[model samples]
Target chain A: MDFTAILGAWIAVGLTLFILSFLYRDNPLFKIAENLYIGIAIGYIFSITIYNVWIPKIYQPVSNRVFTSLSNWVPWVSKFVTPAGDAGSLTPLFPAIIGISLLTRIFPKISWISRYGFAFIVGYGAGLAIPATVATMFIAQIEGTIQPVFKLASGGAIDLSGPALWTSFSAILLCLGVIVTLFYFFFSLEHGKISKKVTKIGIYFLMVYFGAAFGTTVMGRFALLYGRFFDLYTYRTSGYYHATPILILLVLIFFFVYFGKSRKTSP
Target chain B: MKNGKIAAAVLAAIFFASVSGASAEKKKIEIPPLEGLTARDMPYDMGAAALLEWKIRDCDNQDMTYRIFVSSLAGTGPALRSFTEAGWIKVDEFKGNERLAKDIELPFWAWNASKNIHAVKVSLDNFFGKIQDGSVYYFKVMTLRGKQISESPVVPGAVKGNWFNLSRFNNLFYVILISMAFFWAVTHAKKGNLFIRRITGLDAVEEAIGRATEMGKPVYYLTGRLGMGSMSTIAATFILGEISKRIATYDTQLKVPHTEPVTMTVCQEIVKQAYSEAGRQDAYREDINFYVTDDQFAYTAAVDGMMTREKPAACFYMGYYYAESLLLTEIGSHTGAIQIAGTDAEHQLPFFFITCDYTLIGEELYAAGAYLSKDPVLVGTLRGQDIGKVFAMAVILLGAIGLTLAHVRGWDGLTRVIGNLFNSF
Candidate 1:
């Protein structure tokens, strides 16, 4: 292996072990790894915000034109700072102001100013989602469900041909599932005999869905575990020389961290 | 005699040109008049695009090629003849014989105009240069045969954007219907008592907390990454308040580790409010509910480590979770805690199912607090949702039967009628 590949593998193995140690118990090594993970994650997110959010939303638009012929006043600076345009539209300023206002919440004296930011977000979210919710979640979903559950015969009878038979049957099943699921969530209605039967049928569909979901989730987790195991197996490189030291380190951890803890005086 | 014949021929050509100056250039060919030339401005948009459509006059003519030309602010009649340049978008070749050209990449919009006619929809987003709304434009389709040229009448079109789209009238109708149902339910709920079916999952909430109190271990509540403006988080917050109230009476600690600083602040308030309401205000501690790192997996690791070391007797996994669902729950389970998880994250449901003792799935999590609280405002909302479902059932049942009847007995005529009826949204 090259130096970079060898170094990357070593770091990965070391961090994985540091994290995995928590399965046994939380120790100084685990804490160090956890802190490092948080620091790196926060640093990465900050960079992304600058690259994705701040530049596009705030910096470039304002620098291009601060509402007037501000760029023309300083030719040297404007040549470097200004974007190629007559004047940038002032619409971007609203979001920029709101974004800056979110930081004001940290100051107790003027924290109430942040309410405008929160209010804008909440109001915008509600306004945006209501129409979308009605269209997609309510209408479109119903439209999908309400379509013909069975195929009609040429003479106005049901189609029983092999492919058509399965298609029509599954459509009927889907229609049933939708109806029963809706019925199951009907809190205001008392579950009388018919309602009970319908809701019970709903339960069957729900169980099948949950079962399939569980299987998929297991497969996903197993895939991740498999990937980690494969990475560890690559340590067999350089004629098995690295494997011996790694095994010895694990042995030391078991002896000192696990058994040694037990040997301490009773609390 | 030959010069006299040429003079007579020139005189006939001049007479043809004077009748209508259809040609300024060299050759003139008889091009068929294009059919149904129209432009439509898309509704509920920012006045950005215009739809241009024209039927193929004689699509079968093997020797002819068609080219679409557009000019901004090109007027009608004599003024149009004076206009010099007609910027052409594309030229389609007549491939000849029984073979037809394959369906090329079409410019897309919310919906295509129709199937029978040839269509071209243009907007600022797709058109070559500048296309401003409210500006008058002209379109003409030309026919070319060898070196000869023939052109369609100049058709004027202007884009008109609307604030509300009539195409989505059904969507608005649906919204109105639900709104009426909600308002009626709320008004009626205010007047008198109404029946609410019991949600049994909520019963586990109290039991889990009670078990923790008995063991004298703190109850841990992980709200995942559900922040403000999410219904799931709001519901979880309500449930957290209730849990806190119960735990306060028993003098047991409620530990809430939040990933978001904003959520942590809100949770702290909810916890304090619960203690105050329970008449155990002295028992409330601000430090018990605290902010953790906003990092996704890092937050999960912190919670997992805390679960291992502290071994909280009751673990509440609420709001939304992604990959951390299994990790947190598995770690909590290893500590032998009574874990109750409620989330709207569908993909994380299966992981929660295996590890958590009692799981509230999908909409169940949304309805938990409303059901538990029994407040008229919350209950009224649930009632409205139920009413909407009934409306949906009626629509679906009727649509299904209508479609089936249309499909069967080879009555395709029934489909067109019903399709137009149901396709408003």
Candidate 2:
């Protein structure tokens, strides 16, 4: 509503139109917008890492410790120190050292030393991941998959009712899906006549899963598209002095002129 | 008038008797006692926390609520003498039948499997600034029903951390089993007896490269933003090595655009070694492997622009991809390039499947390295992993059957025993 806000909306509308121009064809406007997006994203991530990771984990801790220790030596120095609750531990230095060692890759002579850091990282990650993967992905998955298909009826016989039968059928199908899917990925086993049929069944299950996932993701993409279009429509209001329509009209003209001239220039 | 007076007197007498009978019932009500009350240091964790457990003698009447209180000894010996009721602060309160021991999700080995018992955790550090290991703490459970209250005798507990968690024993057993399997398979593979089934995606990689060679266009390989620590990235690099070697033999230009700088450096060495192995080191260029920005969509956009401009004949997207999977593959699809993608990211597989010519789902990506290299040692690991999967499948089938039988026969104990085998912790 204010001048700066209106100006911001205009800029946003202009960038959005420029980006959307990529759907038409690659042009200077799209390239400019792409480069700006990348540049701004990189800068934003850099500042975020500095504030969130480096300052809190490394800089503040080390500085607080140093200032606290210095303040203990001179009473007047207390005023200069940040109000840290306690003298921070030097434990963060160990990881900080490892992190700095990673930067040694930039130097050719000491690049090999970075291998120690890489080994530490990879070793620690594997050691952590292997157990978790076995537990959550392997054992827990097995536990969740092997549900009881047969339910006891109130008369103490296998349930024959419609709802119970459906439940049992679904459970059996799930179990079958798991078995066949696992068999499909089996490399050591030869896919003979019967094996091929089983694997085919497995492929059907996988296709179903992939199809469901694809449909869901398409819906998500459409939602994103809808959001962008809604923003464009909102900006067309007089509150922003019809910024969307103006920028879109300009982008359309530029696309036509650019494509027409490029076509003429081509041999 | 006489009949009315007699009827009213009888109604008044009946109402008074019913009211007195209700009052008698109220007077006869008694508070249920808390039983089997115990407090101890919680197992499989660092010191400073205690587990309090008790059972209400009669919980069928669900109106009862419980309050748990804890009081910590300030110091050892004489310091403990100063402990008073003021030190006992309420830690938790819950309605009856809530916070049952069975609701606590500890593995069977670590948990006391009493479903009827109430379980509550008390942290000693909540009272003391920093609790010492083996510090003595006392806890009490009080039951409140209507206006009636009954308290359990205070029990002393000592907090001490355990060295090992027995709850994760199953996980450890599986890890060891797979490791042993790997070693045995590797030794056996030395005899050249292992058979790894054909992965059609790896086979397609050759045809894709041939197409690129004939078209005289560069082949692009993009590794997603995961570092060397990721298994998928390592596998991708192995496949890259194999792919690069074949490309060297064909004398086709190959470009690897990396999101992570470390992966780029590693791939450079891998490609160099591959070229040397192919006896085409002279054709290898240092610029083959290059760094791109680590941001996901930005990298995808940059690659999209490049793909549109050059219209590469073949694109290989490997390693762990996120939302960028579809973005890159969709653009490559537009270019009509033969896109082959391999990744362990399950969610991104849908995107790759729809857009790419060849897609490797889940473990197929892990197997791509060994399949392409035909290295017996790596092939042996694949056999070992397959053995593990077969073991898993057998267990799933057997467990399902056993559980189904247990359900039909009403064997709850057997059901639990079988179910616990597959529980993680």
Q: Write the per-residue lDDT of candidate 2 for residues B1-425, one digit (tens) a residue.
A: 99999999999999999998787666545665577899999888778789998774665246878888887643334534443633777888888868888767676776877877778877767766687788888778888877666777778899998888887788898999989998988888888868788888889999999999999999999877798777788888889999999999999999898778778877887899999999999999989998767787777777888899999999999999988898899889999999999988887899998899999888998899889888899999998998899899999899999999999989987787777788887
For model 2, state the Cα shift of residue B415 in Å.
Answer: 1.8
- Residue ranges of candidate 2 with Cα displaced over 4 Å: A70-83, B1-38, B45-49, B55-61, B70-91, B95-100, B115-117, B122-139, B152-163, B279-286
Question: What is chain B's TM-score across the candidates, in the order shown?
Answer: 0.73, 0.79
Cα misplacement distance, residue B178 of candidate 2 (Å): 1.6
Best-fitting candidate, scored by lDDT:
2
Model 1 Cα lDDT, one tens digit per residue, A151-241? 7666667778888888888878888898897788788889999989999999888778888887888798899989877877876466444
Supply the global lDDT for candidate 2: 0.85
User: Candidate 2 - CAPRI tier?
Assistant: medium
Cα lDDT tens digits for candidate 1, B157-186: 777666765656666667888999999998
The residue pairs in collision within model 1 are A153-A157
Model 1 regions more than 4 Å off: A24-27, A72-86, A152-158, A239-262, A265-267, B1-31, B35-41, B46-49, B56-117, B123-163, B279-289, B409-425
